[model samples]
Target chain A: MSAGDDVAVVGVGIHVFGRHDGVTGLEMGAIAARRALADAGITWQDVDFAAGGSDAAGNADTSVSILGLTGVPFINVKNGCATGGSALTTAHAMLVSGAADLALVVGFDKHPRGAFNPLPEDWGIGSWYGETGLMLTTQFFALKIRRYMEEHGITESTLAKVAAKAFANGARNENAWRRTPLSEQEILSSRMVNHPLTQYMFCSPGEGAVALVLARSRRIRELARVPVYLRSVAFRTRRFGSFEVFSPSIPIESAPSATTEAAAAAFEEAGIGPGDVDVAQIQDTESGAEVMHLAETGLCEHGEQESLIQSGGTELHGRLPINTDGGCLACGEPIGASGLRQVHEVVLQMRGDAGERQVAKHCRVGFTQVYGAPGVSACTVLTV
Target chain B: MTKTRQFRLIDPELIGGTEQVPRLIGSVCAGCGTVTFPRQRSCPRCTSEDVQPRELAIRGELWSWTIQCFAPKAPPYLPGGVEEFEPYGVGYVELPGEVRVEARLTESDPERLRIGMSMELTLIPVPGASDTLTFAFRPVEEDE
Candidate 1:
């Protein structure tokens, strides 16, 4: 269970991401799965297990059926926005437990048309009900951004700057949903969704699927074509009754227990420290999450996030390149697929396959974090 | 003959239930001494099965608030679907006993909302709706 343990990610693949061009979720999953198997230079017969991640919405069974996976244990996982990371964690557990030598984790989503609905009233009343209206994720984060601005003397322009940087990064990504670079002025001028958050600051909903092939390190060395060893994987949910008290909205006397716990476990397993991360791909559900993560993950101290942003230390050429693939901000959230996509980006960076968006030097260890709604977060540290 | 159906907004109690009232439910671990909301079945702190349910404090200080201006996708529960409406403010309220809950603020006026302002939870009946309740945060009054 220590760092440099057994499992390695030998293959990663993704289907094209965008507004659905008539591709069903199952078809997308199958394509990504096939590509991953091919990338690992293995056949379907070599796979021992298959797992899928998606939110509760839509007909998940239809998509699972479309995968056409036969004669192997099939597991379905749903963890809100963290479905992708959750699925991977499940697959890794299967491999570590000796249930499967080779496990395939796939995530895909075709968001239901129209507005994202709140979890049904039956799921317990959401935190967002008032005479004024229901609070959605974007609006909730926008409020937090406003508070951060008020306290830190930051401005809407600072948020716009983050958007601009993400858009610029996205422009270099061929698979990115939004490929056009945007200026701070243009971002500021975009239509506002919530005060201080314009349309450009948010990610458009997109459809896509991603597949990751995980194997025991022994199998990896023996049969893998291109292997990215998984040095450490850790998942943690927020402590009870504390989600609302965390940073961005409220300054906690203590750091976020979930992120801290996950990071510590990951580092312990990876046999490394925060200083050792060559590249980072922390979750950016909102721009504010990125700032909070910078501090929570021990990448920077509290109150130093603005300095990191202002110095461009988080940009592609910075000492620690963070979110080099434009992140969820520009890549568009494919819901269940986002976690694996983060892994995919890191694999590409580590493999030196990222074209214009590549970091200046080789990246040996890449760290990724993914957070789910209802206060669940997962972090994974990958090393070659 | 079957009668045609009419649309109406219902209170949270009717929409959810009285069991979901009090607006908050969390777990307190007997072993490690921790509390969490939405009520986990097992104690996350000690991994002990011994845990008890507890209701959260209704009053707290506003951590922050924001007004949503866009239409959310699906389950058009909120008003003003495609058409934009006067925005509403949502904020995290830091309750006594170290619990923070995300809730809608009753006061939509941004000027009235300040960080650290005192607020309390209220179960308001949705207008034109019956037997249903929604939670909102109201600026605390001098008297209970």
Candidate 2:
């Protein structure tokens, strides 16, 4: 009667994650949305409600324009990197409230080149802070990962291993950007973008889109051959003391990161624990993030990453494979679209449709999460 | 002695953002005792308007650090020009009992720096940018 009652993801689609030199963000989003509708075996006019968020650079409400001007309620929710998750959550509410039988969730972005240099003033952080040149998103990932490595016994090798695995998994994904299989040593020796995090160890900002078509259980049973149920979905903004993006300072004693909090909430909502998940796709803006998030999601203990990573426990054949489709590590993040991309991978895995890179174990349940600035995170649990 | 005027790129608050012997300006909430760098109009914690400007400790230990190898974009960050730009070290220095400040690290050699080592603030003059002054933290030598 709660989260997973009758809402099901009948279809999902994603644009290849890479540079779309001449294409606009809206164009890329439209392509993915159309693909999703086609997969859902439904026309655009069949959608009763649409939810999504787009980057300011490309009009936020481009979902309607891209999906064709359906007079349905097209609500665009913007919550940083959690935008896609927010879209799914909003659409699910419509089904639960008996407001809509079918819904569409779309997310897309075309990031500016180079590292993200957010105007400090825009986030109320002031220009002097930006002038310090310390607010670069690269540095944020580097600093946090550096601190995490020190606190936890995570070795530089462990970081390299995560990237190596991600790139290897990404190599099997036709939609991934950096599909070249990277060895651990090569990742370790890549150009140092920031200490502890080499260039290969980080996900670059890129253009892409992801969309999901959802329907009530009744409609899904009739239309979809195998409906992937939305087990749980949750989004959380950063609470006080979190060392999130654009923060001037964090409290000495603080709550866990946004991803950690959201993961806990998603698990609780679904009444499922980490052990129940057969596959997972977590945030990996940097290799360290994947490591930290794996532990934060209660998938493993804080200091267990060193041994777990060495045992190849997170590989595709492992008991609980993580980042099966390379995750953000191989497919550079497109912010709004990244969360749904995680969902798409989980859906494909659940449906036993993933080729080559499919997990060795049957994926009955899966998890996906995304985290971003000024401080926000969204997580969802899915199952067949 | 040559005379030169010093300015904080935008705010005057950063110049004295810390208190103690070095004195960095900060804001304190009368209701909740919350202290923040670059003085704000009110307390973020208690939503109290009784927030007043105060000074924060200038000394702290190194919490974490990173090196910015790429040149920041032109507008907000005046890192001279790309050719003139050199990679610099930055870190979050934790002023015990106060706030952890994000500032440029004076030390670039990772070998010489330790996470818990004591750090002291030192103002760095930015060239090309007229009369601009920025801050950095250097590892405090035992002999000093």
Candidate 3:
């Protein structure tokens, strides 16, 4: 068995991103699953195991007949917004362990709109802190970036560029939730939800679903479709002294984020550096997020964002195109599906199937990451 | 005079006792000397069981902050209602030789806040909150 021959994301599907009225999250999940099955040139019966992730209730649990009553081992996984990435990690492990020849990973959510107000104890945070109304997800992100800006000299314009790029790319994506392109001024002028985090800069909570079908080398090689192999899947939770969502207080000293830790492990496992990534899809829960994440993912050094973004180096035609499918900025986050949607975009980009927003460079590899509330992160590397 | 009640919204240990200096109470590890606010049971850094509660610095530098323009959801969160909603500043104050604590700010005006500026502990009544004491930070008043 070759080192990279364990399993591949042979097929992928999505139910767009946005409010899907009159449809249950289960229905959206099933629809996306069928699309993924069709894309894989297989059927529900072929799935030997199922892994599901979602933050809301009802849908993901009794997901058996939604795809067909296969009586498979349906393992439900949840890692906040990293739900999809977590599911992929589980499905990949099952395939690598030789536990299943075919595994289906799906993430779908229809959560209540607006910012999340997760309980403290729910994520192991202090109850005294949780009751104080400090649980808004956006403020956590803003606070981290605010400190980063102080140390790194990142200006408000640098943050605006990230949002502008998302809408520009999102305008070309047929499945994007907010296809209306936003100018930097509009994004800057949008109502300030939090200082430096204007309304347009923050992604909304919306509904969507995404799914992936994975298989072994022999099973996937025979298919006519060009295989988008799963190079590595890494997951990491918050470590000590890390400033994260719902954390009321941190130690006197700060530590590297979970994303940084997960990215390091992913790079080691994939046998690739950030430079090897031809395309990427990092979590952009807010405009400043993409900037900080670019540094956290090791794609760039601290304080390099001002020049990197100002130079249009992160644009679709720039040195390193990121979030080509609009990301959460344009798609609005549907927790469970957000991570998988990122992966699906990478799959499309790697396969040379991304129509309007395709990166012109010779794309050999792609990376996607998801960071979520209460300090958790998951990353995946893909190559064909 | 109309009778009124007051209380601390957070833990009592967080407040300064007798001195009225508003020293945040935390825990220090005997093994690695790690300091944590809200007082962790065990040392998160060294996993030391010999951790003890220690009062943190009352004065700090504002590392970062955000002006929350909207009120959060109700039921256990909104000490106040929609009509009472007012924009507020939320920030992390990095204390000398201690941990960074997230807290509400005495001032919400963005113009008055600057990173690295000195801040001192104060108290605020959460809108719609009944008999609760929550702490906040203000630009240290000049020369007392």
Each prediction's TM-score versus the true structure: 0.81, 0.95, 0.96
lDDT of 3 by residue, A34-132 (tens): 899899999889889889878884547476776678788889987888888888888888888888888889999897877776766776665555446
Model 3 stretches astray by more than 4 angstroms: A1-4, A57-61, B1-9, B79-82
lDDT of candidate model 3 versus the reference: 0.84
Q: Which candidate leads in TM-score?
A: 3
lDDT of 3 by residue, B1-144 (tens): 111343554557666543344566788888988888777789888888999989777788898998888887764365554458788888999988777889989889999999888898876665566466667888885565
The TM-score of candidate 3's chain A against the true chain A comes to 0.97
* C-alpha positional error of residue B19 in candidate 3 after TM-score superposition, expressed in Å: 8.5
Best by lDDT: 3
Per-residue accuracy of model 2 over A266-339 as CA lDDT, tens digit each: 99988889878899999899998899889888888898988888889999998778898998989988888899
Query: Over the stretch A49-87, how does candidate 1's per-residue lDDT look in tens digits?
Result: 878776633434354455555667868888877788888
Considering lDDT, which of the candidate structures 1 and 3 is the better prediction for this target?
A: 3
Tens-place lDDT digits, model 1, residues B1-144:
111333222332112213223445556678875665546567655688888876666678887777666555434444533344445667778876645666667787767778888997665544324344456679986575
RMSD per candidate (Å) reads 6.0, 2.4, 2.4
Task: Give the alpha-carbon lDDT of every model.
Answer: 0.71, 0.82, 0.84
Ranking of candidates on lDDT, top first: 3, 2, 1
